[model samples]
Target chain A: MKSPLSLEPLFHVGPAGITEPVVVSWAVIALLGLGSTLATRRLSVIPSKGQTLLELVVSTVDSQIRETMQADPAPFRALIGSIFLFTLVSNWSSLIPGIEPATAHIETDAAMALIVFVATIAWGVRTRGLRGYLATYAEPTWVMIPLNIVEQFTRTFSLIVRLFGNVMSGVFIIGIILTLAGLLVPIPLMALDLLTGAVQAYIFAVLATVFIGAAVGERHKPVAPSEKEP
Target chain B: MRIDWWTLGLQTINVLILVAILARFLFRPVIAIMDERRAAAAKMLGDAEAERAKAIAAREAAEAESGKIAASRDAVLREAAEAASAEREAALATAREEADQVRASAETEMRWARAAEESAASDRSARLAIDVARKLVARLPDSARVDGFIDGLARALASLPEASRDGFGAGERARLIAPRPLTAAELQAAHDAFARALGRPVDFAVVVEPAVIAGLEIETPHAVVRNSFRQDLKRIVEELTRHDGVHR
Candidate 1:
């Protein structure tokens, strides 16, 4: 069996080599773009079934953004919604024969985390001016600034690691079982992998919301004890 | 694990492109349509409420007009009832007056008819009594009764004054009316008796009149002596008619 950690290029282009995960991400982008276009082609006051489904997805994303970020969903909807969609689709791509899920690769997870890191700063700067954004690190005391700064990079690193580890480990475990026990024996594990992939996508999107919410302004209201994450 | 910086950059670019596509195509359009739908619903609700208020006002106006019409109808009915009552009363009074006049006329006619009937009956009775007396006198010796009536006629003539007796015996021929045709001897006897009573001779022409009912009457040129049962009955009937007239 091939190492799950190794990257192999199907083709090399001049000086740079394009790996499998990069190509798969392009496919995910094309699929989402095409689906979004077709779903939104003929919008009216009264919605068709496909249009309603798309609206439901958009509303759900908006609800999530509002609940997690304590802010309007409009500014963050594209970034957070795209991340979740891409990760979820990429993770589910494992069901396709001869296609590795892009999120199972560290490169894809890192790229998604890097986009979140950049968007967090941009949103924070837009919400509060640059100086105010910088001043947020010294929040209850100036003594916490260095720790807060390190916490930012570490959290982004954690997002990358968390997604890559869960997805890649599920892929590796299913691959190992398929190698040892044959194809049908790995079906249950693949199903678990699919579940794990969906959960990881949710976690990634929520964490992005939390990080962005913190940067822009936590604006956190008190939640009921029952509503708190246990 | 090995890092692929090239793959990372490409994936990042891909994700950004996806974000742009989804935001432009999916979220913006959907949210806009929802906003539009909400606005349209609100506008429809406002229009419906306005129409409902207009309908209510129209219904109320109709009810008000109906109430006024009902009141007018009641007034008209009241006036008609009063007019009808007055007309009925006047008609009843006129009918009563006409009935009373008819009754009075009928009563007057009845009284006159009763009086006339009574007069006819009395006349009939008198005639019947006269006829009965004639029949009775005929059953008796009529010649004997004629001598009594002749004596009554002589007495009536003797009661006259001398100048009246002379006038009675003088110019025109005198007539003697008898109840039956008298024989020549009776005629001569009546003439003698009449002449003796007058102290001058009276020429009395004899007349046979059964209507005298067994009595005699003497007539001269200017005077008459009535002495018969028919004359007596006529006198009694006249007195009774005079008394009846006075009572009336």
Candidate 2:
């Protein structure tokens, strides 16, 4: 079995090597795309079971984004919902034989985290203007500017590390247990790994929502002495 | 751990593509359909509310109409009752008037019948009395009946007015009527008695009149004196009829 930490190249396109995680990510994308298209094709006011399930998923995502950001979910729904579905599907893809979960690779997790980081800044700039977005680092006092700026990057890094570590460690531990013990003995560990995969996907999506919400959320201004007294 | 930049790039592109596809096919359409259903439900509710209001208004109008009909019906009933009462009263009055007229007519008829019956009864009693007197006088001697009528005639002639006595002496023929022929002595006696009672000379003739029943009547040119059972019976009949009328 391949090491969970290393990504084996499946193909090469000139200077860039196409890896297993990247190929699996394409499959996940295609599956999600086809499912969304089919689910939405015959939508009506009166919904079927499949349409109901799809709508539930979409509304759940929208409510989460709305609650976290304290803003309209229209602008952020597509990106946040896609992140949640892709991570969830990718984490569970390990159930298929000869298919490793794309989220187990640091590269895929980092890419998703980088996307979230970039989107947060973009949304912050859109909501608060570029100068106001930059002003968030200097909040409370000017001395906290450096630490606040570093905290942004570190928080994004933590998002990537948290998802990658949880998913990759679960895969690695399950592999080690399957190697040492009989196949039936590792069934409990595999079940636990599935639970861990689901939890990790949820955590990754929740963190992304928080990071984006922080960017688009209204800044709390310090109340004056007179206002506080009231 | 080795970082693969190409895989990172590919995964980011895949995620972006997934976002685009999912948003286009799922989020936009689902939200739109939900909004449409909500709007449709609201419209249906509004229509139902409007229909309810219309139904209420129609019911109110119907109730008002029913009230009006009831009021009109009551008025008609009252009028009909009053008319019926008036008609009944008028009918009663007419019936009473007819009853009064019938009663008056019946009373008049009874009075006329009573008068006729009394007159008939009195006439029958007088005729019976006259017949009895005539039969009794006929049973007596003819001379006695003649002598009795002659004395009554003499008394009646003496009570005559002076003008009637003077008219008898003016040379008009005078006659004496009797139920039967008189004897010569009886006629001479009647003439001498009449002359003495009249206080002048009077020419008298003897005549038979069966209609005079059993009586003697002295006839002069201007006066006739009757002293007979028939005259006495007529007087009695008149008296009895008057008495019967008074009693009634």
**Best candidate, DockQ:** 2
Model 2 Cα displacement at A69 (Å)?
4.7
Give the docking tier of candidate 1: medium
Please give fnat for model 1: 0.85
What TM-score goes with each of the models? 0.63, 0.73
TM-score of 1: 0.63
| Cα lDDT of model 2 by residue, B1-248, tens digit | 67888888988887888888888887888888888888988888999999999999999999999999999999999999999999999999999999999998888789878877877877787778778877787787767757778877888877778777667646777787887899999888887887788776667677887666666987665666888766777777778878877756
Q: Indicate the DockQ of the complex predicted as candidate 1.
A: 0.59
The fnat of each candidate, in order, is 0.85, 0.84
> After TM-score superposition, what is the CA distance of residue B207 in candidate 1 from its true location, in Å?
22
Q: What is the per-residue lDDT of model 1 for residues B8-42, given as tens digits with 9 covering 90 to 100?
A: 88788888888888788877788888778878888
Residue A200 of model 2 has an lDDT of 83
At residue B225, give the lDDT of candidate 2: 80
Which residue segments of model 2 deviate by more than 4 Å? A1-3, A66-72, A128-151, A210-215, A218-230, B68-248
Superposition-based RMSD of candidate 1 using all C-alpha atoms, in angstroms: 8.1
